[model samples]
Target: MELYKWSAQATGLGCYAYFCWCCFLGSLAEDINESKTSCCCISNILAVYRMKVRATLKIRGDSFSDACVVCWCPFCAGLQMRNELRNRGLA
Candidate 1:
């Protein structure tokens, strides 16, 4: 009877250890997912900011603006240029 009791206790401890390991792994996965999500959010924000800054510079005839002109989506940039021109009384 004593032997049986010891075997049962050992089995229970093994199961407990397994459960703890699984929980730890699950938490690690969540942390990785959160990090990836935050990175994507930051990348999107930077892209939008770059677009706005490019538009502003293009409208102002800044030399650095000539590096790349995304003519495919010209409306935003053109509007920016027009607005700047109007603001400067050059329109």
Candidate 2:
């Protein structure tokens, strides 16, 4: 993929961009889940986030898995997400 090719060119930008993207995604996921869940005493929301990423990206998502993928191919990943959401009537 183009990501593999360009990743080497933008090492600095990739690190910065990828970090921001991962934080954004994690926070976004948390916010959505919090909105849907009214109960308290939940501290393991990130596990739910891992599952969401795994389901959406169709890949095994460890702690850094989503970050690596977004780092590899951010544009493609975003496009894929938009398309998936639109298809599911959530976009």
Candidate 3:
């Protein structure tokens, strides 16, 4: 995958993101029996963040699709976003 090829070029952003995801998952496991809304809280936040990143980067995409992509594979989404920012000399 492109991610693997670009692993050597990856910035600290990806590692930070993966750490956050791991922490979120750990907390979620502890609250596995909690409400659905609680479980979705982090996903929703990340989705909104993704939308903002897309908008700020002037990337052409719909918010809903961005949310879907973030929710589906946040690790990849974060990596792509970081790469975009780096490419633009903003990261």
Candidate 4:
């Protein structure tokens, strides 16, 4: 009778250990899935932000070039020169 009781207790302990291991594995899988999802979200957001910054920089560069062209033109250069002279009280 004592031997049977010992065997039953050992079986119960084995089942409990297996159950705990399965729970730990399940939790680990969930954590990995969450990490992957978070990484994807962050990457997508960065991609969008990068595209917007590129577009804004392109527009700003184009505007600056246009202004430079206007300022360097003979017709517009005189106006700018006069404005500079006036600011220096030389006009």
Candidates 1 and 4, the one with greater TM-score: 1
Question: Candidate 1 at 71: error in angstroms?
Answer: 3.1
lDDT of 4 by residue, 1-91 (tens): 1111101111222333345533422332242232323323332322332233224233222334434533454223222322333344433
Which portions of model 3 show Cα errors greater than 4 Å?
A: 1-41
**Each prediction's TM-score versus the true structure:** 0.26, 0.34, 0.56, 0.22
Instruction: Residues 16-70, candidate 1: write the lDDT tens digits.
Output: 3345533422332242232323323332432343344335334233323422332
Clashing pairs in 1: none
- Compute the lDDT for candidate 4: 0.30
Global lDDT scores for all candidate models: 0.32, 0.41, 0.55, 0.30
What lDDT tens digits, residue by residue, belong to model 2 across residues 1-91? 1111111122333343355655434434443453424222122443444346446545443546545555666534433443444445543
Q: Choose the strongest candidate by TM-score.
A: 3
The predictions' CA RMSDs to the true structure, in order, are 29.7, 9.8, 9.9, 36.6
Clashes of each: 0, 0, 0, 0
Off by over 4 Å in 4: 1-72
Residue 21 CA displacement from its true place in model 3, Å: 4.3
The residue ranges of model 2 lying beyond 4 angstroms of the native Cα positions read: 1-60
